[model samples]
Target: MHFHGTEVRQQALTLLRGGSENAEVARRLNVPLGTISYWKHVDRAKRGEPVATRPSLLCPLCHRRPLDDSAYAYLLGLYLGDGHISHYAKHHVPSLAITLDDGWPGIQDQAETALRAVFPHNATCRVRTKGAHNIKVYFKHLPCLFPQHGPGKKHDRKIALEPWQQEIVDAHPWDFVRGLIHSDGCRITNWTTRLVRGERKRYEYPRYFFTNKSDDIRELFTDTLDKLGITWTHCTRNGNPFNISVARKASVALMDTHIGPKY
Candidate 1:
């Protein structure tokens, strides 16, 4: 459903002022996330409105919010390290910078005090306390850097589609504006008996998509993508699904060759 121009601007402004998740809000509003961000920022500037902070991240005592990425990064680093770094900073790193030669005992106390003030008191602080060397090793060598910082935590986790899903998305015709490939239409065939191995029987689901227009969708897609600063390409034989299937091009392409752009 297309939105009226004024309605679109109003929704965008609400999302911007509220710091709502752009993608979810856009999906809910049936507008592209890029368009939402663009209109939100633009409308705010046009109104000479002061950008406001989402209250969730503000310090309870001061009501101050993070002003820069570095500050957020520092908070994230600290959160990842848990109270371990803070503990070490308080008890061991007596000569550490910031808190002077005595270390950050007061700062550590204030942070803990600040956290309890913000989060539920029943939620215990379970930050693992360890020496600096061990903490450093964990961050550098761990496959998942911010393991505990998931979708529910104070940070937003990156959502990555599975390899096959990525392949389908990559293979999607680029010129289309508002088309969607079906979630469950894809299928994969045999060649697997002697080609690959697992301990026992293998069961899997590989998917394909429905047929749709290319260029018209591409115009809409391009408009949204330009606003969002994204770029994409037509699928090539090198794409994972293309490599797996017997067909050189996507089956969807076969159904409607006119829908796709030249690679």
Candidate 2:
């Protein structure tokens, strides 16, 4: 929800300096209008071009204290997998919420840890909804945390990382992958039967599988795998919902080393 990255600040400055109106720039960039106005004031002050009162540009989460790269990357993956950002028109409040099955207390704890790491100033609360627990972070700039947000299911919309987000994910690929797997993937032992010289044999092996309806999300998962030298395959069951499987023994071992089994 906070804009801490230098890249995002630079982009806002460029757009404002190019004569884009504040509201239009904010709409186009999906940033809060206050954020764009704050940057514009900063630019004018720097150029001695002058004017109104100087409002503080410091964001509590982003400026006073910032999230570490690892935490941010993990949270990003979790959001992409099972999170959503909501804006209420009446109250004009934006919140980032990650929903997890109520059964997985460990996963809920991990998500809480990541959220707390990002917003130490704010308390992370868990609300029960239906059969899931929702971890919510209320902030004005929630969209900044998830620039890929749009209307409807993720698969029906395009998902792409901003430059700053890409840098964060690139630096902490393992953590990102761990978050993705923790949210939507699993490590399990699969068994199959084979006939060997008129005898039947059963063997068990460990493999990892991740399923997501979004093509872009799937691609992001596989791209991270490729970067980490992990091998994976695209698979389909029945007719819908794509999956990626890391079934090769060596690859599975490598993933185990990095992601292990979720606690």
Candidate 3:
């Protein structure tokens, strides 16, 4: 009566979704027919259940496939910022969910687009909730791709990238920055009044702010900024160092050209 619970369930789910009959799934996975039925019942979520996917091709680590590093890097930043990877004790498969504000449909589109680009073999779907669209995908290799996936909130633990992931970020720094900004950062105008030759004038300048509770995440942001020759400062409010501001004129100009306000 004992079968590989996790692996068998995953294969069974794939087979069932791929148009295989229950008997066939039980045979292929060497699982009992009644167990397969029970599994299917539990497998479905409220909305948009995922179809079968060949993880070998979809997974960069499991097979020798060409992965879209640029998209991966961008998605990584978003994941570190506002994304969550969840798992159930019984289910082996892990789900990657990125919470994006519904206000900006364009950014949500880009997020889903990037997700599909990286895992072209898998089906990506979005679920709408109050004022936000949760972009999500299911895959076995998600943890392999985003090694930062672990128990507890990211800010509660250390967050660092693997060497290979770092290479991707280094190659596509702007994309990474844009992803972080899109998720946890914003660009706003700051105005001030100055006296110019006995005349009062108002000056407005655009500045970008990236706020995250994780210290390691903020450090990664500043390190990348250094590589891009972008000037940034650590902003503290009420004795907490959790905000990074790109307010310098030249840096803000660079941010405008590359990572403008998310529309």
Candidate 4:
């Protein structure tokens, strides 16, 4: 929660020494911007740089991770699919929110758990809006979890993984795939009517489908599948959003083993 006086000062100093901007430090620590400015001014004076003369008292100082695998990978996948990172100019806060169907409490719990795993310091809260529930994590910056964030729709923007992110994905591709499918994809049994020996017969089969508007995101899904040796088919639907279908029994079995059916 809340940091005070000496603790705040120490944390601010640590961040400042690490070359974090004053505004960033202020936002991250939830301290007043002016406080960071004052600390910076004091530091400058000690460094023999140009500084305004202010009351300098020897006030006591005090003290103060990423989603990579498992829960983190799952969270990342959920974010890439249903979560959104937004910046509020008025409050100067950057927040990440993931909305899930309130009807499914288990899914909401999973989302909250994943968010907590990825951002242990931040508080994860659930809010109900209309018929849906949202699990939100707020912080000072967006890059902490959503490095792929940029201007415009995710589909319209380019999405690429950093080397570290790639490494995580490479190590836990199954979890990553599970997250993606749990958020944006679905597994269902479909029934078809066919003629067998001149008689009408109904057959049922299982299939998994993932849909998104971003080509890059679609590629990421398929590429991950390729690495896992799972078969999938990509096709454009309505000449806008695209979809990937995993219908073969073996592929479906593999996905079931890794991702399973989202509850």
Provide the RMSD of all predictions against the true structure, rounded to 1 decimal. Answer: 24.6, 12.0, 8.1, 9.6
lDDT of 1 by residue, 218-255 (tens): 23333433443333334333333321121233433442
User: What ranking of all candidate models by TM-score puts the best one first?
Assistant: 3, 2, 4, 1
Query: Per-residue lDDT tens digits of candidate 3, residues 61-120?
Result: 777668998998899989999899888656477888999998888899999999999988
Q: How many backbone clashes does candidate 1 have?
A: 7
> Cα lDDT of all candidates, in order?
0.35, 0.83, 0.88, 0.78
User: Model 2 — TM-score against the truth?
Assistant: 0.74
* Top-lDDT structure, candidate number: 3
Clashing pairs in 4: 155-214
Query: Any runs in candidate 3 off by more than 4 Å, and if so which?
Result: 1-58, 89-91, 237-240
Better of 2 and 3 by lDDT: 3
Worst 10-residue lDDT window for candidate 1 reads: 93-102
Q: What are the models' TM-scores?
A: 0.18, 0.74, 0.78, 0.72
Give the alpha carbon lDDT tens digit for every residue of 1-263 in model 2. Answer: 56547777788889888888999888887889988898888789889996574222224345443557798889888998999988889647677889988877888898999987876666678999998899987766567667798889888999989888888899999989988998888898999999999899998999899989889999999999999889899877687558999999899999988888776
Error of 2 at 48 (Å): 17
